[model samples]
Target chain A: MITEGRAWKFGDNIDTDVIIPARYLVTTDTKELGKHCMEGVDAGFSKKVRPGDMIVTGENFGCGSSREHAPMAIKGAGIACVVAESFARIFFRNALNMGLAIFEVPGISGGIQDGDRVSVKHDTGEIIDHTNGRRFFAAPLPPFMQEIIKAGGLMPHVLRKIRG
Target chain B: MGQTITEKILAAHAGRDVVVPGEIINVRIDIALANDITAPIAIELLEAANIPSVFDREKIVLVPDHYVPNKDSRSAEQVQIMRRFARKHDIRYFFELGEMGIEHALLPEQGLVLPGDVVIGADSHTCTYGALGAFATGVGSTDIAAAMITGETWFKVPESIKFTYKGKPQKWVTGKDLILYTIGDIGVAGARYKAMEFDGEAIEALPMADRMTMANMAIEAGAKSGIIAPDQVTVDYVSRRAKRAFELYVSDSDAAYVDSKSYDVSEIEPQVAFPYLPENTRPVSGAGTVPIDQVVIGSCTNGRIDDLRLAARVLKGQTIDRNVRLIVIPATPTVYRQAMAEGLLETFLAAGGIVSPPTCGPCLGGFMGVLGPGERAVATTNRNFVGRMGHPTSEVYLTNPAVAAASAVLGRIGSPEEL
Candidate 1:
């Protein structure tokens, strides 16, 4: 699967509380969560983000708090994918479980800047910076994890297994 | 290859002879925990998957301590849904409001977790049980749903980082300070996807409470889990409360580690994490007089009996600043009862502080003393990310119980020595 989008860059250690504050966790509605995505760190994030936009960040993205809401909000806000130097363990799993594509490419942040046109190939683990004509590679997801992403997250993945 | 303690625990749970980092393996879960906030969504996912019943009701534990006492109609509905599900499924470990406590703190105290077990919870602090020598980690609700249906989950055996502490901690410097200093030394992402295996003479000398405090914040440094090898101290603590016999495991002497570091605690001072990230730490002596609107001394991190005793000792015969509101919350009802029995609660009350029952309270900004806009707080809870305690403009400084109590008295960031 290939995804193309504009990049939105952030610094290192963007915690879950910055992605979605704990106060907005009262509801499980994806839209409600998306509405407040990145409110803590960037007040205009939700309003400015467009569908198919990608998030690029430095290391330890989604570092604090184990709330799955962080990734849910990122996915809900119509982000096509997230490319980070690294991710907190729980956030990495949560993003994939919620059907959001994420990639870890060393120095990926240095290659992309805010609003740069970028394309990602999930199958090949390649990230292309269209604006700067730069190419980078990310570690490909393992087969089983790719299967879950293809099924639109863990719930559906489990459901498919149950049916089979 | 010889295995680290984490690999050993996972190998045992997976029924394998050996395991290695980056290898995916399925393992049976000894315990699956969820609190009110995460359980409702997990229940929905479970129903969506068309799973009629849980794999083992007895292994599932639900605690509704996040917004307990029904903070609002929506929260009340959420808790009610979990309550109904627990009752219908006959999950033996469900704890209602009166018996409810923060899942991380209450689980071990209730003997729901044992040594060498593979545990997962919907909350991040679930890693706290690693102090008991368990391979416990946090997962999302959908993962919990999958675990509920199958009684097992998959894990990529993680690389391990070894932390060795030497000498002794100074007075009023506790595990909270040590862990804070460690996180500061290693950036927030230092141990991503790795086990933080804590060892050393100083670690062995730490009390169970301090161990829990350290383990509780492992997630803050992006660790999969923070673990300590089971020793006589751990044995004494777990055997007295564990309902069943448990196996103890330790790392092999030749176990490989991705990285290792050593610290001398006698040279370390009390530490505090500044706002926005836990890694932004500075010693209390140099933290300057950053005035605070509130001081919270509780949470799964440093909310035990010893934590209360430390705070009470600092607050004895001293009243907190009138401008600052100090909120003390016990992590569990058992801890609360013990504090009350020992007059800790009375001392807090006398010091112009509000003592609350066992609840997560303002730790996650759920309720109970939410800060106003631009307000700053010094708290004993883990995590001080942007807007963690209240409004988006609010800030929180993370510190130990001694610093929190002393800061409350001085109306600024202070230490126990100032008291």
Candidate 2:
């Protein structure tokens, strides 16, 4: 699957604490969560985002806590993919397991500016920044993960696996 | 091949000789835990599972610590749900307010965890027990419920990272700061999918409480758990608190480590995380004086007797700023008693600081210590993310107990030495 969007920039260590504050952890509804996404760090973030927009961040994105709400809120907010220098392990796995597109592009922070358009493929490592006309390499998703992403998250994937 | 502590525990629970990293396997859980905030959701999930009873009622530990004594009607309802669940499931370890502390502290102090066990709790700080040589990790409510019904959960054996501290810390530098420095060096996720083993002279020289603080934040760094080889201090601690004996083992010299790093303890300094995130930390001196509305000296990360004593020492005979509200919470009931015995509570009370019953209260922003819009606090709790303590507009600055106490006196975020 291909996704393209304008970029929303965040610096290093954009933790789950900032992505979705602990106060909103009471609900599991992604839409309710998306409204609060990044509201802690930037109160207007939810209002500024549009469908298919991407987030580009510095190293150590999604650090602190294994709150599943973080990625759910981001994906629910209609972000296409998050390109970061690095990702916290649980967040990385959880994001991938949930089929949320995240690219680990070291030093990619300097390459993109806010409002730049970018494109990504879930299976391929191809990432295209149309605004700057810059291309970056990313690790390719494994075949199994492709299925998981296509199925739309771990729950559906697990359901399919169990049914089979 | 030599097996590390995590590997050994995973193998034992898997009923296999050895388990490799990145491979997922379902293993039997020796214990399952939940605090008041999580127990309700976990119980709901448990009911959804349609299990007549928990796998082993004795294995489930419930504590109403987050908002014990009930912060508000909503919080009280959550506690009541947990209480009912515990009663129906025959969970004998349901701890009430005056009887509770932070779940992590109370578990180890009450002899509930032992070496080489696989334990899971709904609270992220559950990883704290790994300091005692148990392979414990935190999970969500559903996972905890699954464990309650089946006594099993899936885990991907994480790779191991070894950190060695070379020298003694300078005066005023603490294990709390060392953890911050290490997190800075590692960039928050360097130890992802890994178990970090703290070794070398510096960690050995530190007290068990400080070691627990170190192990506690390992999760923040994307580690499976952080552990230090249980030494004489560990043995003494277990002997004093636990009725049964535990066999603690150090990782073999040849144990495999996916990554290894070392630090100079003497170079470490007091660290502070600004209004944004825990990992966005700088040395305390680098951060200019920051205005504060409150100072909190408690949480699973920093609420202990040593932490309280340090804060009390700073507060003794010194009045806090009229604008500042300094709050202290002991990690457990035992720590509260110890502090009371030592006159620390009296000192704090005299200083105009409120001492709350031990719970995750302010840390998870569950009930107590909710910051209002535009309010800023210098807190010893982990994760200073904006709105983490309460209102989305409120800002939390993370620091150690000493700095928190000093900030309370100054009515702003400042280092202890500055005071």
Candidate 3:
């Protein structure tokens, strides 16, 4: 899988409350949550997003809450991909569990800027900053996780496993 | 090589005699939990997967404490989904409003979670059970759905870090202060993806309530779990409430650790975390004279009976300051009844404070005491993140119950020493 989009840069410790506040957690609908994505961090952030846009952030991104709504909100806000310096453990599992594309590349946040065109390759774990002509490699996904993504997320993988 | 307590518990659950850090392994789950906020999503995903039956109805625990008692029509509907699912499956540990508390506190209080158990909840504070020597952590809704169907999940073994506290604590320093100071030392992501094993004489002497408070905030330091090896205190706490036999897993003396830190508790003051981050801490004595609009003393973090007792001790006869709104929530029905019997409820009421029933209402800013724009509060609940208790412009100062109670009476961010 590959995705190319403009980047929205964020600082470290961009927690879940900033992703989608608790008040909006009343629903699980992706689109409903999408409208409020990053509402706390940068108000009207979702409105500025174009389809297939991506987010580039610093360390400990999505640092609080196990609410998958954080990832769901990002995905719903038309973020086709996310690349961060690091991720909180639960958020890393959550974004992938939902089939969202997220990569971790050390120092990528510093090189990238808002609206920088970026592209990512899932199989090769390659991340390219097209505007700056710089490249980085994310830590490769384990085979089982790669399989989960190939199946379009954990739910599909589990569905196939139980149904098969 | 000797194994850490986390390694031993994971190995037992994985059906192995030994396991090493960073190795991915599949393990059986002893308790699979979800609350109203996250359960609705898992329930929806379970329907999408077309799985007709759960792996074990008995092992699945559901609590609707996050936004229960029907916060609104939407939250009401969300909880109904979990309620109906619980009834359809006859899940044994389903807790409704009256019986429910904060899921983390409720599970341990009811003895549903035991030492050496593998517990997973679709809530970040699931790590709270590690206080009882369990290997527990938080997961996402989809993961909870998978566990619901498979009765199992996988984990990458995490490296262990050891923290030891020496000497005795000063007056007004409780588990909240200790954990706050630890977070201050380590920074938010200091223990990311690692197990924090809390030990030493101070820890052994700490009560179960304080122990839970310490473990509950491990997530604040980006740890996968926080644990204390079970001792006589644990045995006594569990034997009274736990109906099933439990296993106690302790770290071998020679266990490996990625890092270790020792602190002299006598030198540590009652710490308070400033707004925006739990890592931003300061000693209470120097916490500038900032007036507060609200003082909340309850949540999964410090809403236990002991916390209420301490707050009541500080607030026995003093009325809450006219400028402050004091909202106290008991964690569970049992705690509420106990407080009533002990007149803690009367004390709070007489002090001009309103006591809420067992609900996680204000902690996550869900309801009950949400801060208005530009308002500030001193809360005993965990996480003073921007907008954690209400408006994004609002600020929350995180402290222990005694400080919270005193601050309520003083109408500012002061400690019990002031009273």
In order, the Cα lDDT scores of the candidates are 0.89, 0.80, 0.93
Task: Residues A7-97, candidate 2: write the lDDT tens digits.
Answer: 9999987877789877676555678889988876788788888878889998778877666678879987888789898887667766865
Q: Per lDDT, what order, best first?
A: 3, 1, 2
DockQ of 2: 0.31
Give one digit per residue, the lDDT tens place, for model 2 in B1-419.
Answer: 89788888888889998888878777999889987766776676556546677789888999877677677776677788888888887787998767877888888888888776788887767788877778888776656766776778778788889999988887667778888778777855667668888889998888877888888888767777888877887777787777555667678778898989989888888888776655678888887767889888988888989999888877888899999988898989899999999999999999999998887777866667888889998888877765678887888888888888988998877766766
Error of 1 at B300 (Å): 0.6
- Listed in order, each prediction's TM-score against the native is 0.98, 0.85, 0.99
| Decoy 1 TM-score against native | 0.98
lDDT of 1 by residue, B1-419 (tens): 68899999898889999998999999999999998888888998877666789999989999999889778898888888898899889999999877887788899888889889999999999989999889899998888988998898999999999999999889888999989999999978888888999999999999988998998888988899999898998888889898877899999999999999999999899999998788999999999879899999989898888999999999999999999999999888898899999999999999999988788869888899898999999999998887899988889999999999999999999998987
Q: Candidate 2: which stretches are off by over 4 Å?
A: A1-11, A28-30, A44-58, A75-86, A92-164, B67-69, B243-245, B279-288, B372-375, B391-395, B412-419
Residues A1-164 of candidate 1 have per-residue lDDT tens digits of 88898899999888888899887777788888998999887887988888678999998888876678788888778888899998888989988898778999989878998999999988788999999999999988889888888898888887778778
Candidate 3, residue B139: lDDT: 96
DockQ rank order: 3, 1, 2
* Native contacts recovered by model 2: 0.36
The residue-by-residue lDDT of candidate 3 on A80-137, one tens digit each, is 9888999999999999899888888889878888888888887788988899998889
TM-score of chain B of 2: 0.96
Q: For model 3, how does the per-residue alpha-carbon lDDT over B1-419 read when each residue is reduced to its tens digit?
A: 89999999999999999999999999999999999999999999988767789999878999999887778999999999998989888889899889999888899999999999999999999999999999999999999999999999989999999999999999999989999999999999999999999999999989999999999999999999999999999999898898787899999999999999999999999988999999999999989989999999999999999999999999999999999999999999999999999999999999999999888888998998999999999998889888889999999999999999999999999988787
Best by TM-score: 3
